[model samples]
Target: MKTAIVGAGAMGQLFGARLQLAGTDVVFLDTNQATIDVLNARGVTLQTESRTEHTPARAARASELDETFDLFIIFTKGFHTQAAVASIAHLIGAESCGLTLQNGLGNAERLQEYFGPSKTLLGVTDFPADLSAPGMVSSNSRGKVRLGALGNVPRLPNIAQLLDSADLHAAVEQDIRIPVWEKVAFNAALNTLSAVTGLTVGGIGADPHARGLVASVLEETLAVAGRLQIDVSRQRIEAALDNAFAHHTHHKTSMLMDREAGRPTEIDTIGGAVVRLGQDNGVSTPVLATLCELVRTAARPGDNR
Candidate 1:
């Protein structure tokens, strides 16, 4: 399969590199000229805990891309979804499948807007990675992705096999929206708190006050999910939080990384989405609202205070 991964960020590079090593023809579409130049010139060095491999890469901007792609894997930030798709819409072929392996909610809708509802596969991943340098990426821990067609799509299996070839465990899910909600709820609790407080996941997990804050936001999310008849539980999400404290204590979430990089976060997609859903469903989300406000304020550009 000829695959195009948008957004040459950590996850994008990681997926592209692994897919390339697995002998899939992988190319990246990014607006960043510097990253494109580096990828096309030196390729990438992919390092995991157990092994390291050199993977050749190809990249092009939307304007430079002249070939059709079979698979379009979106790894861009949630906020950039629309622009990213617009940039490369011309590359999507009649038989093409679009997959979003990004964080947070509404990705399916964004992808479907351009790629068609049935042709879009929405998924989530926890494969933690960092772009060490221009052409260097490191996957800190092993993780797989769960993908499900937004509607009855025939090419779903083909998309899954494409990732399977790359050794990326892209499991097909019958009901993916629930998991997407659960993951976003988890992020609303952990990512927002860590981003606002400048604390590691462990720091927030260990603090009683922070735990209360997490509970508040989580309960609100659960309430919203319940109203929609989604089978998400406070117990399930809370247990995941406890497990995260134990296993991912040292890990910084994507939101925290964005803050450190001075990049805008997907607070709107996670926390902000929670609050919006609550309002839409007539459920109140005071905790998420406050956290969203604080995060947006902190992320404002050129703020000296």
Candidate 2:
């Protein structure tokens, strides 16, 4: 299949490289000129604990994609989702599948707004990767992604087959919204804390105060989920937290990487989403609200304080 991976950041490059290495024809669509140039010239390079491989795939700015794709994977930052969709809409044929493995909520809805709801496939991944440079990615671990049609799409089997063909384990889920929220809740607990504190997952769990902060965030998130009738529990949230700390003990979250790179963080998508829900439901989320404020303040261009 002729696949196009939009966003072409760390996660996009990582997955694109993997599919290309597996002999699938894939290209990366990104807005960053330098990164696109490097990718088109040198190909996508990735180093994982198990192996290192570089695939010579095409790369182009989002505007340069003139050919239709069988699969168009959306991996852009949440804030950039709308723009990416607008730019790539021409390349999305009716037969193409739009899969969003982005980090937080609202992305699926945004995608559905552009492509028909039937063409949208929402999914989540726990793959941990860091983009160390243009055309280079460090995939610290191999993780699986769960994908499902958002609203009765007919391409579930085809999408699953493609993933299986590429040796990726993607399961069909009828009720994926729950797990998406679960993952979002889990990320809300740790990602913002790690970003604000500049600490690793293990580092946060090791500190008494940091651990307490994460627990507080999780508690508020669970309360919000309860109001939304999602059947989320503190036990489930804590268990996921424990698993994250155990598997990616020393990893820094994407939020922290954004902070380090002087890029805008996904505070709006993760923590900020929680804050909005709290306000809508009249639920109190002082801890999450405060954290969101601090992160936004830091991400501001001129605030330079």
Candidate 3:
């Protein structure tokens, strides 16, 4: 399949490199000239725990592209979702589909505005990709993707097959919201806490108070999910948290990385979204709400408050 990876960040580079290596024609779409130039020149380098591989890559701004694609995978930060998806409207054909394996909520809806409901796919992934430099990504672990269509469509399996062919460990879920919400719960707890406290996964796990705070955030988020009838599995989320705390101790969350770099974090979509849902559903999420604000405050450039 001919695919366009929107947002040439870490996750975008990781998936694009894998798909390109798997014989799929891939192009990266981004606004960063440095990233686009580096990718076009050096291609993409993906480093896993086992080995490092470099794949030839192509990248361009939306105005520079004149070809349509079979699929457009969005990996932009949540705040940029609308503009990012809208920027690629010219590259979307009648049969083209848009998939958002992005974090948090409301991404599929944004894609639906352009691709229509039947062509929008919503999903979650646990894959960890860290950008060591432009055109270079490193992942220490393997992760799976769970996705499904937003509207009644039969193309879900085909897309999953495409990802599986690239060794991305993709699976089709009948109810994609379950995994999506469960992941939101996990991130609501770990990502927000890490961003605020500047703590690593293991650092939070090692502290009794921090661990207790994590538990509170998780409980609050799960409650909100339950109130919304998402049926997210608490056991699964907790198990995932335990695994991360144990094995990915030194790993910094994307939110934490953003905070440290003075880049905007996804607090609005991840933590703030959950908090709003809780309020709408009459579920209390004081802890998550407070952390959301704390992360926002911390993310402000040159503030350091």
Candidate 4:
């Protein structure tokens, strides 16, 4: 099956390279001229803990694709989701499945609006990726991805088969909402804390103040989740938090990286989501609310610059 990877940045290129190495016809789509030029000139460069490799594939602007795709894996940044998908919606056919593995919440709902709920697949990945340069992705950590339908979509089997064929370790879940919420809650807790505190994942875990802050934010988010009947348990979120800090401690979060690079942070999607949901659910999330403001304030005109 022919598959297209939307937003061929770090995580996208990592998946594209792996799938191509497993002998899949993977095409990469990105708007960055440098990224496209680099990939077109050489290939996708993947660097893991063990080794590095370059996978060859067709590179094009999303608008340049003339034929319909069987599947489209979207890995765009959270803020760019709508515009990114809009650029390539014409390439999606009736038989195509669109999987969004983006960070934060509301992404599946956004895709549903564009591609119809029946054609959407929700996915999440723990892979730590960074675009060290154009066409070069620093895949410093090996991670797993979970993918499934959100509302009884008809294309999961076909999507799963294609992913499995590409050795992507894909699975069809009975309920994906729980996992999605769980991931969002965890990101709400740690992502902003790392961004504001300027700490590594390990640093957040080790520092008593940071750990306390994470627990407070997560506890408040769980309260909101409970109000929504989402079952985001403190025990589960805490365990996942610990696992994330332990496993990815050396790595910097995307938020932290963004702050370092003087780019807009995803606080509006992650922690800001909790604050918005809490207000809507009538659940108070003081910690998360405060962090949201702090991160936004710090991301001002010349702070990170």
**Among these predicted structures, which one has the highest TM-score?**
3
Give the lowest summed-lDDT range of ten residues in model 3: 296-305
| TM-score (C-alpha) between model 4 and the true structure | 0.92
By summed lDDT, the worst window of 10 consecutive residues in model 4 runs over: 135-144
Ranking by TM-score: 3, 1, 4, 2
Rank list by lDDT: 3, 1, 2, 4
RMSD of each: 2.1, 2.4, 1.9, 2.4
Q: Which candidate achieves the best lDDT against the true structure?
A: 3
Each prediction's TM-score versus the true structure: 0.94, 0.91, 0.95, 0.92
Could you give me the TM-score of model 3 versus the true structure?
0.95
Model 1 C-alpha lDDT per residue in residues 37-143, reported as the tens digit of each score: 99999999988898888977888898886888888999988889988998888888888888888888887788888888778888888787788798899884468
Model 3 segments beyond 4 Å from truth?
301-305
* Residue pairs clashing, model 1: none
Query: Can you write out model 2's per-residue Cα lDDT over 1-305, one digit (the tens) per residue?
Result: 78899988888888888788878889888878888888888887788888787788688886766778888899998888888888998888878778899988889888887777888898888777777787888875557778886689888778877776664667777678777888988888788888788899989878899989998998898888888887765676789889877777888888887887788788888888988988999899999889878777766475322
Model 2 lDDT at residue 163: 73
Which has the better lDDT: candidate 1, or candidate 2? 1
Higher-ranked by lDDT: 1 or 4:
1
